[model samples]
Target: MKTDKKKIIVSVTNDLVSDNRVHKVCTTLYSMGFEVLLVGRILPHSSEVKRQYSTKRFQLLFKKGPCFYAEYNFRLFLYLLFAKYDILLSNDLDSLTGNFVASQLRNKPLVYDSHEYFIEVPELVHRPKIQSIWLWLEQKILPKIQYAYTVCQSIADVYNKEYGTDFKIVRNLPLKQNYKPAEKQSDEKIILYQGALNIGRGLEQAIKAMNNIDGVKLVIAGDGDIREQLHDLVLQEKLHDKIQFAGRLPLEELAKLTATADLGLSIEEDLGLNYRFALPNKLFDYIQSQVPVLVTNLPEMAAIVKKYDVGEITDSLEPKQLADKFREALFNEKKRKVWKEKLPFAAKELVWEKEEKVIQEIFKGITR
Candidate 1:
């Protein structure tokens, strides 16, 4: 079958060049013979430019203060006006409006990729008015969208059941197939956490857990709104040596750090629908690195942990209970080795290659 060799424009509200979901999809589509154009902003005076990849990035001016959305929409509108694309792939609800307008003008098919159940994001949980508005936009836009995809099964099911519209499931698995196997380190037992340090991620508990464990270090990678508080917690606990926050390391360095870990962490608090069904990238990263994961006993996370027999899960929410779970996971070598042994099988099976077929099928459907 001759695949569609077409130019695909991916409109992302956030910085697409930095996002894992967009990076995965763009790389996959490029491999499948689509020219991917990533339209988004580059940060103010940030010279950290990535050279390789088929993606042609368009830089939008950085906007300041509370009226950022207005500026974002304006820049996006201009990009849509000029850029020529066969298909416009919208990342989330924020970019859907621009895609809707662009598609209407260009008469191109639009694909809405939902990375989250947007209304269930932490930012929207409190602001009911904004939540209602966004939810309404989603309801209106999603049904009208010709092609759509989401991160996990739970999210896809929710969209289907709620909107009565069909969409594809594109799991957020990384392209890399092999990684360093889990091995015992002599100097420092590293407990790795690599994801957005959001409100319900239980970073505080992890910090406290560090206080209990000796000769062990907690490596917190990545950043978010809760980062400052986490830093403050480390200082308060006098765990400067114990808890090291290396914020937002690049993917290569991040993987290297993850590969060297004694154990991986993915402790998201059970907050809303998203957190309840959280399928984090860090879990698979841990798997690929062949490190045993110590994660929360959430449905999505537990399934992976149980299936591979990798590490432990804290079924309870209490900080002390979490601390105990961490102690047990970090201290035990035998169980960690067992989890390590099984990781190769799990890593091979649970990867982007397995998920690619479904994504390809969706594109085929759209093309036909």
Candidate 2:
């Protein structure tokens, strides 16, 4: 059951695709000589998963809601009990319960990676009773976690203060690239929004803003809760000619679409602390594509925009105001030249290679 190299069982709640941060972490672990096995759940309509290491995806009894979480965790607990792993890596709150219990019982090291301020996410912000259940889980488990890290400084500070735990910062950055994408041969310029089509993501305002932004197509390249609503809004607003729903794409295809764009967007509305402090993975993906971004004037994202001189930051998501931003990003030649020159340096600096060293530091002496 045991091999020469240590075995790691990395767990996440989502299907093993599109979650670049967790995917990068698992890849890094394997490169460091660990035998990696990534475990996640399978939806009825989930895409096929292809990874370098061994993998498993559970077909659970429930699809979503509380029952799904319970079923997944219960199933995961049983799997971990029998699975031979020297270390356990849990991504986010949903998978931590099983990993935590298994770690204690089997005397294995556990590392927790919090992808976001989970309880304060917009989905749970209005549901206090449901939020409390997650809060309770965090309260009971987080303070006891030794090797824990999060995506940004804001989330790390909040968790460290609340739980008195020394949580590290491992930002959601893309892998370093040596390849260039072929530019589009289209006449119309493209303005892209390439993350989840979820609420509080400023997609509605972005679509409305396109009414005045002539000659540029607004390409939405992901799918989520607001999928139908967004499609309806496009027709209702009569923006079929101006807006294109690219739907959810795999990372490679998404990068090509991103590279073809004139500008990238990460204009999340400040609904809760989760959104307020979000340093979205799409932001880094844009950088990797060398596409300049127009992002919210929130602390975490604004810091990157300002620090790198990558693009503009706006305080409002008003349709008229958003149109102004789009116009400037698309047509302002002087600003475009500045952003174009700055993007490569930002891309090189903000890569997973630098962040994975911190992971190495956390897991030092962890292998036998």
Candidate 3:
């Protein structure tokens, strides 16, 4: 991990502390005998980060919206233009523009890591004009790109068809675990949900379902757009004691709580293709923690639960129906035993170390 031995510069738009996926990517690059310079933006409320590799976070005047994108991209473009690196790695569409422009100008290889279907996310699906702008950029740049990867196959298939690009799959998997399944001692349960508390994440339904279920506390971790609203809803429902808002914790701290959960929730509504094909980090984290998952019938999430026999699938978004499924997932002892036992197997197979092969293959082709 010497400073003098690297050739890659990675860029993203988020405050770097909570972005475990990008952090893992940089670590992988570092592990592959390359020094990595991870670049990002720092917000006023962003927590401090300490990592082995180098990082540079810009302070932007504009926090969000069009102005933010324009300003960040312009700043990133200038930084990447002069930075000493042979390869550029961009995470998601928001970070791609500046990296793309800089890569083209400097004749360096650019690798795109599309975390989700950019335009199909709930934020952009309703806004035609804004979505169209991103679509335009994606269409113009993707085809000509030589190297890229995405989180799941469903999204990769979409991009492969539309842009005729050969994008590889590097899912948001966690590092391998050495966890032991602990027997539950209390009748009380913790039904945990972690990740962005955004719209269409099924947080509202899960919160509402708490009223019908007894002796189970729901722990929601992470922050996002709908955080305040979800808190207000819990207060209104008078389920404050039953629902605990743990907010955002460091990666290590979150896993300790996840390991104690009787059940983990990843019930995202199919608001658009983004949610429908979603394979989020929390699902894998749950497996690593040896917690059984309760995921939606969405293709990617359900596929993991089914293939691994580590969890169950739910087709309902209603509170009462969801409550029923929650009860079964939590209390069905025979099924719970099988799930808890199978988690180690699933965790071994779907780990970040296994994914290093894909990373090596992609970089070999482009780095040459």
CA lDDT, every prediction?
0.78, 0.91, 0.91
By TM-score, the candidates rank as: 2, 3, 1
Q: lDDT tens digits, residues 1-368, model 3?
A: 23346489999999888899999999988887787898899999888889999999999999999999999999999998798898899999998999999999999899999999988999998999999999999999999888999999999999999989999999999998788765677879999999998999999999999999998999999999999999999999999999999999999888788888989999999989999999999999999888899999999999999899998899997999999999999899999999868987898898999986898877766655
Deviation in Å, model 3, residue 9 alpha carbon: 0.7
Per-prediction CA RMSD (Å) = 2.2, 1.8, 1.7
Off by over 4 Å in 1: 1-4, 45-47, 51-66, 182-185
TM-score of each: 0.93, 0.97, 0.97
Give a tens-digit lDDT track for model 2, residues 132-187: 99999999999999889999999999999999999999999999887486557887
> Which pairs of residues collide in candidate 1?
none
Q: Candidate 1: minimum summed lDDT over ten consecutive residues — where? A: 51-60
TM-score of decoy 1: 0.93
Candidate 2 at residue 109, lDDT? 94
Candidate 1 per-residue lDDT, tens place, 33-59, comes to 777777776665433646235444445
